[model samples]
Target: MFSPQGPSLRELCVQALSSVEHGYDLLAPKFDHTPFRTPQSMLDATTRALSGLGPFRTGLDVCCGTGAGMGVLGALCQDGTTGVDFSSGMLGQARSAYPNASFVRADARALPFDAGFDLAVTFGALGHFLPEERPALFNGIYRALRPGGLLAFPAGSRPPVTSIAHWATLGFDLALRVRNAVWRPPFVMYYRTNTMQEVSRDLTATGFTVRTVPLSPPGYNLVIARK
Candidate 1:
């Protein structure tokens, strides 16, 4: 489901075979044109949901790509926003796109900030982390936020086992496993890596009180956690 402006099949194949950071670097230029970018509708809904909860001062976007989530933070945070990503190419695009916002290249599991953000959010990035790695990621987010600060992200409900989306995701993850087994650097993006229950538990264990706000279009869940 890529547009004409998106990566070609050969380009995508090369990316899929590379490490996650390298793959994202290769895909960053066309990322917004692909289905990978968080949709504007979800963005708007998240903004609306955060409206009453915010008026936040400083915000951070974890794994922010081309800075789509920065738009939401710009509206919600008064002091400005920051977008952090491991991919240099993505951060480069983000810096160019949102010159007013700060962009940093850093690992989400070991964020550089210390209680520096009033709010934190992520979009379409969790699947890159293996389930076991989530605890560290959540802990880093919690440490980055001030006490009582919030962390938010949109998550999709699990697709039905019989649905095409389900089978497609399963096959994709399986293929990725096979590819990684033979590859030097592993690419880590799997649709089934994170689940609501597991994420909730991890967040709680990492000192966040989690809550879910049901989003529109029926399949989305907006998770808000307070540190």
Candidate 2:
């Protein structure tokens, strides 16, 4: 699933053994080469989907990682784009790639931003937050948006029970549970936890008018929440 330029298996093992923040720091340089990086096509599809909803002013990308989501925000927002992530190494890479865009180092659970952005987007990061953590996460995103502003992210629908991906995801989460049980620093990446019903309920409770926008690339939908 990784390109030749991506982290070696040994390097990935070291990263999996470290804390998420430090692990990301170690993996930052090779991250974009990995399949874990959000694909350009997904970002393009999202931009096309959000274009009608936007042409926004200031944009924010929460848990922005290597700043892939910024492409969408940068295109849609006339003013500027900002990417917030806790890993300094990740932020460094983002800043290097998109120097004109603002990059902030902050945890997603407690985002350090006021209601100042017209639009906010996050990608490939929800699996990092557990079920109980959703409340704090959704609330933080809610607080980061201006009145009538929107927070958006793409989430994959559950793979069919008959599909290989379904079994693979289940096995991965099980392996993670086993690893966390025996390991020191848990790598919190679960693929199948964020269901549409559960996430919509949380977003609604956090004061967003939630809706799902179906899009291309198959089995993916944009979860749009308006304040």
Candidate 3:
């Protein structure tokens, strides 16, 4: 599902064999061209959904890659926006793309913020964290947000087990597992790592009141949590 300008098979293979950070570094240049980038439709829908909750002053785009979600923050947040990511290469691209927004290089697990953001959003980054890691991740997001602030992200409806998409995703995760077992550094992308039920539970445990709203352009759901 990659475009002609997207990574070649060999390049993808090499990336898949590397650690998550390094793989994202290699992929950052062509990330927006791939299906991996959060789609514009979803971005628009999220913006619309968040607009009602906002008039927010400062917004944070967690794991912001290439700054697609920054556009959403720009529309919703009035004072300023910040995009935080661990990958320097990705942050570099985002800086170039959205010069107005401040970009920070930091791990999501240990966000270097203290109740500074009115709204926090992440797109297409949760699957990189295993299910066991959700608590810390959600806790960090909760910590980054100010009291009564919201955290938002788009999650898709699960594909039926009999669907080809389901099987393909399963196969991809299995392949990644095999590669990581024999490789030096593990590429941590897995298709089945995040589930709605688990995510809701984790957010609740982390002191967020979680709710899902259907996003238009289909196949997507918006998970909005308030601290």
Candidate 4:
């Protein structure tokens, strides 16, 4: 699932053994080459989906690893874009790719901004936050958005039990659970935790008016939460 330039299997093993922050720091240089990066197709689809909601001013990308989501904000926002991530190495790569955009190093659970952005987006990073941790993360994002601002992200339907994808994801999560049970620094990614019902409930509790629209492909939806 990786490109020629992506990290080697041994490198990935090392990363999986390290803490999420330090693991990402070590993988930053080769991250974009891996399947782990948000796909360009997904980004384009999200941009098209969010365009109609716009006339947005400054934008923020939470957990903006390598800044792929910034391209979506860049298209929809009239003002500048900013990317916030905890990994300095990832921020460095993002800064190099989008020099005009701002980058901040901060944990997503405790974001620093307060009502400074008209729009915000996050991609392929939800699984990093466990079910209990989502409250703090969502609360921070809610605080970071200006009144009448919007937060958008893409989410896919859960795969069926009979599907290969379902089993693969299940296996991955199970393996990670085992690893975390014995490992010091747990890599907190799981594929099944963030369901539409769960996320919408959380967003609603945070006072966002939540809604969904069909995206480019089937089984995927663009979640728009207005502040």
* All candidates: CA RMSD (Å): 1.0, 0.9, 1.1, 0.9
Residues 182-203 of candidate 2 have per-residue lDDT tens digits of 9988889899888889999999
- For all candidates, the clash counts are 0, 0, 0, 0
Report lDDT (CA) for all predictions. 0.92, 0.93, 0.90, 0.93
At residue 210, give the lDDT of candidate 3. Answer: 89
- Candidate 4 lDDT over 43-125, as tens digits, reads 99999888887799999999999989989989988889999999999999999999999999999999999999999999989
Cα error, residue 8 of model 1, in Å, equals: 0.6
Q: TM-score: which is higher, 3 or 4? A: 4
Better of 2 and 3 by lDDT: 2
The regions of model 3 sitting more than 4 angstroms off are: none
Please identify which of the two predictions, 1 or 3, would achieve the higher TM-score against the true structure.
Answer: 1
The alpha-carbon lDDT assigned to residue 175 of candidate 1 equals: 92
Per-prediction TM-score to the true structure, in the order listed: 0.97, 0.98, 0.97, 0.98
Model 1's TM-score against the true structure: 0.97
Please report the candidate that would top lDDT against the real structure: 4
**Candidate 4 Cα outliers beyond 4 Å, as residue runs:** none
Instruction: Output the worst ten-in-a-row residue range by lDDT, candidate 2.
Output: 1-10
lDDT of 1: 0.92
